[model samples]
Target: MSGMGSKMLELDDEDELKDFRACFVDDRSGVNYLDGNSLGRLSRAARDSIMTAIDQEWGVELIRGWEHWGELSFAIGDTLAAELLGAASGQVVVADSTSVNLYKVIMAAHSLVPDRRVLLADLNDFPTDRYILEGIAKANRMELRFIATAMDEPVVADDFAPYLDDDVAVVVLSQVNYRSGALNDLAQIAYTVHSVGAMLVGDLSHSVGAVPIALDDDDIDFAVGCTYKYLNGGPGSPAFLYARRRLQAELTQPIWGWFSARDQFTMAPGYEPVAGIGRFLVGTPPVLQLRALEGALTVVCEAGIERLRAKSLRQTELAIELFEQVLAPHGFRLASPRLGPERGGHVSFEHPHAQELTSILLRDHRVLVDYRAPNRVRFAPSPLYTSFAQVYEGIMALAKAVES
Candidate 1:
């Protein structure tokens, strides 16, 4: 290792949270892991919890497993709200995929503002987001408005200001922009949307466990996110939904599922929406998938989101420093914001050879980071499992990759 790289490792050794790194099993030894923003390391808690559920709950109980399976969604949802979501229990539910949840809330939010014929969105927001709104508009025969742009930059706060009128149904955006890691000022934007009588929705896919969020305090009408990232719930884990309490009664969902009926098991002939956020649920939920997230949340709540966030900031700061000190000379322009508060738990940098460089680092250097289109590399500091040493080692490997 270079003298600077060795010092970065020593800097990590002095950290108090360094010992927590051993809690995860790693076959990618001699590699640096910086991909936690995309997928987090499986925690020992998740591993043990899943095994116990399989062996004791499902294996032994079998048909009698309905009791444990039923409350798993709400139970986990309660913990997420109390610890991470910053809302009351009934406000959040682990159900369906993110796209499904987004569709449910988008249509329902429109219903609340009947005359609103336009849907405003970021042209550069995640592709799925833009596509979803387009589909919504096509279904309703409305216009999809893009934020005004000049000099090739995206629409900022001013662009949103002009569009905030009663005619707009819902304004959708990412809480933390996916590709750029730019954090939108949610509370301010939420207030703005409400002032103009529009519902505000955020896709927290990149922010939820990576940063602190308060859906209730912000008076956000709706929100959705994938759990596979920082939640470490494993691939295809159940995504979560949040519908503000005040709007719960006014909004009606598109899908009418048995689990969401007033008396779900009565075999009711007609659809009567159940009270509270449960009405948003559709179809029979996958208990097995919910169980994985349940186990993961156990670890997350135990550690406290506040502590995790603090460590996350430190880790990202260190990674950026190492890049500026070591990799910047080799040809990497910081893609993520330098101001910590404005960015999420991840950092991205531009490298002309990013795609091929990622392949070389993963195959030869054992350093793990992901590449987006064009020329960008994203490094996530998943506080629950990532450590300062990994950041130091990963960047040093990147510096080597740049040379090779």
Candidate 2:
């Protein structure tokens, strides 16, 4: 475990998710990908499905495909919501980028609680969440509170307790922290936010496909996530937004387009929002991309999230063990929390030369991982396709890169 030469042969031998590894294209060639946190490997089902969608649907159906295309977002959302989101149908819809969905839901949520005027975010929250909060606050002249921000490093689930206050309109929390691979307690935070008369908005961009969640059971007011990460829905496969069924009536949809109207067939003049979650659709559904996502989602459903969670824990644990054995001697400090509840499917390590070292590892050793600002390399081990051998080898390369 401590040496750096070759461990993949044994590591891959022990991987339970090894059989499912063939499900993806692994376009890496000779490269070892440890960056599922950034972008997931292309699934075979997704690739084949997109091929058919592009050639057959766009080619043959032409302009007459609206009948089915119109409902693609909802259909995909229903499966994802029912199977993965721990919620019933009619609560989620696939549309726009995670940023856009955040904007939509935040806007709607603010309108619902007009009297409150503060938005709360943690120090380790993703950059996009921070940026979206800043923008939303600036546009509305509301205040953005970076709660538990200063003198803070690696804050855990209980760290949010001090920041729960009555003046906050909504608390935007990432279900999983981006750089450190830390996980948040969604239900507990949701309850906390509600206790102070504030709604909770969660970003599941890193949680949905890797772990399981129960929105309705948790009484979560709003949620949003991207498909291309853990969902393996190809690159930039749009995103999905969720609204509690009862709360849908309390907030007006901010996104406007013909596809989100009550009746698009008549081409009416009046602008009326479509009922329920459909009202959040900004434009025409990306039919081909949606099809590709649906295909990838089918694979996730087939594999199942519970099994995915268990396998992800094993792979990440393998990586962490390898790091402790190999990198601890060298100088790469473990930055991510070791406990299970405080982690997602990825791991993080800190080294002063992260930027240069990451580039070197990629160029000279064919290793792929992401570098956060300052000094951190994030390695995301996707449960469905990535193998333990890959993680073991990637860590060895990291150890060698930093030492030699």
Candidate 3:
């Protein structure tokens, strides 16, 4: 180990959350994994649970497992709601992908106020979100308005005040910016949207699990997020959506699969949607993937989201400190918020050759950080398994890559 590695180990020795690292499978011993914001590292619990789901649930119980499997989506969703999202039990359901969930909620929002002819969204939201909003706007013949925000600045409630009006039916925003890790104030944005009689559709894909979210308390009209990222649910794990209980009766999603039918087994001719959050379900749940997510969520619940959030803030602060001390002198600039509370779990830096440097770090040095478009390298030190020592080593590797 190098001098920086020794110092990092000293910091890790003092970290109270160091025990949590044992829960994950650390196969790449020499590689520092820093892309948890894009895809979380799989935990050992998730591995064992998936095996049980395959061997015991499928191999032995067979089709009979559907009896309990049928409710896994809602059950797991309720767990996520209570543990991660500050939401009510009957308000959230796990189903579909983030794009599909967004489509359902956006359509529901449009149906509520059919006369409104404009849809509002952030100009720099994730590409999939922007694509969904574009399709919705084109399909409904409604005008789409985007709020231009600074790359490094968080989007606050005041940012929407100038653009919001009676004509805007829905305001779509991401709780955290994917590239910069800037955290938006959900409560204030929800209030601002409601004040203009517009529904707020939040994309919590990057915020949930990494940061604390209060969907119900904030009065968020609709929200969608994926389980594959910070949730550590494996690749392509099912996504979840939240629809406030009060809005369930009035909202109607476009998809009308058997799962969402009032009496699913009836094989009914007409499509009668179920009451509450179940109405958002489109088709049969993915049992294997759901099981994987349940296992991962079990770990998250055990650790406590609040504790995870505290540690995440601390890790990010340390990463920023290291960047300022080492990488900043090498022409790298901070692209995320300087304040811990104002940012999410990741720390990003803008360099002229960020993409090339990211490749060099991965290929030559075994450091793993992801690069965003243009010139940004993002490092996410997951609180669950990532150690402060790893963050220090990753930055040192980045410094070497810059020099090379």
Candidate 4:
């Protein structure tokens, strides 16, 4: 074998998470998948757990399953908090979509600082986040201000310096840029926002499972993320929301449902929202999806986020290295940060024909990648399942496709 191939083998062998590949279902269709940052591969544990829930819990237990299912969201949330997110128990819950959760948390945080009339967010933020904030600001007669930054650049405290003020009640940010994969300094940004007496609401969908987050240590007031991507909970899986324990008491999410009611089983007439994280929940929890997510979380917890982060850095480093050696010469410009610490688990390359190239790679080259907007192709090297060999092969395939 060539030196590069040998190196790939050596790296794969040295990987502590290599054994985790077998824990997930193998993709035997001869396709190289590099889009886990968009949607992670299905894990065997999640599949088996979902099946068991269908057969035993829903099939046999039926209505009685509510006994345990009622608290599953909290249990899973605590697991996510302790394992992936650096947060405490009773501060996170698995329920609703990221958009819904963001809406709830943003609205709740806004209420806390009703005197402030402006809400701030990055202009290039994910569509759902921007939209949610926009709607909230418009309906509540508040101004929605945006911090303009390059798509490939990380949003820093300095970037928000012009926008930070006491009038800025809430500042929304993504832990990692979805398009360029640029990781933000959450702690520093949080301090800046808080100094201005503004709350920080982070959208962690793109970084949750792939990156390390310290919600409590960072002093993030509110955050939301989806499980379908790096969490590998399957499509449309339940997302999670986090509210600082100190803020939970005063925060009241706009959504008021039986599930959020205090003594919810009482089905009482009045809407007295629960005291803790459960108050953010709107309606019935998606039991089957939560079970699948619970199963997926077990793998993440067992592998350890610190270990996962180390592997992620190595994988993204290799990806950028390979891209520079091969694809860069083929009119592919690096869109994401060249430094690993400033980036997430993915690397993005910008090409004029990114959309066409993406389709060609998927259909002809049998390499799975995803494209964004006018000209960006993203490769997510999931640390748990993706091997170094696959990363090499995926980039090489892209080179060949571009050259053709």
Count of backbone collisions in candidate 1? 0
TM-score of each: 0.94, 0.94, 0.98, 0.98
- Per-residue lDDT of model 2, residues 211-330, tens digit only: 889889888899999999988887889899999999886788777788788886788999887788888898878888898898888778888888889888877887788888888888
Badly placed stretches (over 4 Å) of model 2 are 1-11, 26-28, 149-158
Candidate 2 has a TM-score of 0.94
Which model, 1 or 2, shows the larger lDDT? 2
Note the Cα lDDT for every prediction shown. 0.82, 0.83, 0.91, 0.91
Model 1, range 41-64, lDDT digits (tens) per residue? 787767777787889888999979
Question: What is the lDDT for 288 in model 4?
Answer: 97
Error of 3 at 393 (Å): 0.6
Model 3: lowest-lDDT 10 consecutive positions: 1-10
Distance from true location, Cα of 402 in model 2, Å: 1.0
lDDT of 3: 0.91
For model 4, residues 209-240, the per-residue Cα lDDT tens digits are 88888999999999999999989999999999
Give candidate 1 misplaced runs (Cα > 4 Å): 1-3, 26-30, 148-156
- CA lDDT, candidate 1, residue 387: 66
Rank candidates by TM-score, best first.
4, 3, 2, 1
Candidate 4 runs further than 4 Å off: none
Query: What are the clashing pairs of model 3?
Result: none
What's every prediction's RMSD, in angstroms?
Answer: 2.2, 2.2, 1.3, 1.1
